[model samples]
Target: MTTATIAKPWYREFWPWFLMAGPFLAMVGCFITIYFAFTQFSNQPIQEEGLVKRGLVIEQQGAGAARQAAVQSKP
Candidate 1:
């Protein structure tokens, strides 16, 4: 005796939705990240002069440390 087997539709299946949820959530997160990137950070202005001053301060501190190291090595 042979029996008939019934198959469920693709949308009614659990595995397809479970597998698709990963990429679907990833795409949603990607869109949110892009929106924040353009809206939150793109409006900020760069401070070139402040960056230059910070670089000069760091260089001077490095030179001061080098001078101290040289003085200690001389003895």
Candidate 2:
């Protein structure tokens, strides 16, 4: 009688690397996102248009609240 044994490398199997790739890529993506988030910030002053945009937003919010109050007061 003869017996034979086969030795296989771990990376030759599909499942282990497949399972690992997801979190490995996710961690890489996380680090990239964090790097961009931290490094991309700037201290430049807001443009004049941005201030006007904020004022318009505030006006719209006040108008919406007044409309809501008027509707609620009716019934």
Candidate 3:
């Protein structure tokens, strides 16, 4: 006995659409992220002197953290 197979078009299949859903959602997410990055995030110009100022602030913070650590270690 021989069997007969029925052929169907690609669009009528479920797997193609199922596989495409992930990439479609990813592309949509990327577009939304880009929109927010341009509109919501800040565009700042940092001056050369600002680098020194930032470094000084970070150094002071590190010194404070070190003092805290030293005090904690005394116990």
Candidate 4:
């Protein structure tokens, strides 16, 4: 009887190459995507005036004046 040789897979054969390559490819892809995003962002600059900035602005009208007004305005 002849002994059969085990055939390795393409991925298995390429495992070390993939091990070194996978992260490198991912990093390159990430940088490319980031560059594209930044380029698009820079190309179309955001309009500060058009955007609806949702928040609150509490100006102290004046504590003494506010107190006087509250007292005067009370029914």
Please tell me which predicted candidate would have the highest lDDT against the true structure: 1
Candidate numbers, best TM-score first, in rank order: 1, 3, 2, 4
What would you estimate as the lDDT of candidate 4? 0.71
RMSD of 2: 10.2
Q: Give the runs in model 4 whose Cα sits over 4 Å from its true position.
A: 1-14, 43-75
Better of 1 and 4 by TM-score: 1
lDDT (C-alpha) at residue 7 in model 1: 92
Tens-place lDDT per residue, model 1, 3-66, is: 9899989999999999999999999999999999999977655445333233235222455677
lDDT of 2 at 4: 89
Comparing 2 and 3 on lDDT, the stronger one: 3
Cα RMSD (Å) per model?
8.5, 10.2, 9.0, 10.5
Which 10-residue window in model 4 sums to the lowest lDDT?
A: 52-61
lDDT of each: 0.75, 0.70, 0.73, 0.71
Provide the lDDT at 40 for model 4: 72
Report residue 12 deviation for candidate 1 (angstroms).
0.7
> Which residue pairs show collisions in model 1?
none
1-75 per-residue lDDT for model 3 (tens digits) = 999998899999999999999999999999999999888753643335224234235222455677899999996
Report the C-alpha lDDT of model 4 over 24-48, residue by residue, as the tens digit.
9999999999999988755553335
TM-score of each: 0.57, 0.47, 0.51, 0.36
Clashes of 3: 0
The worst-scoring run of ten residues by lDDT in candidate 3 lies at 50-59
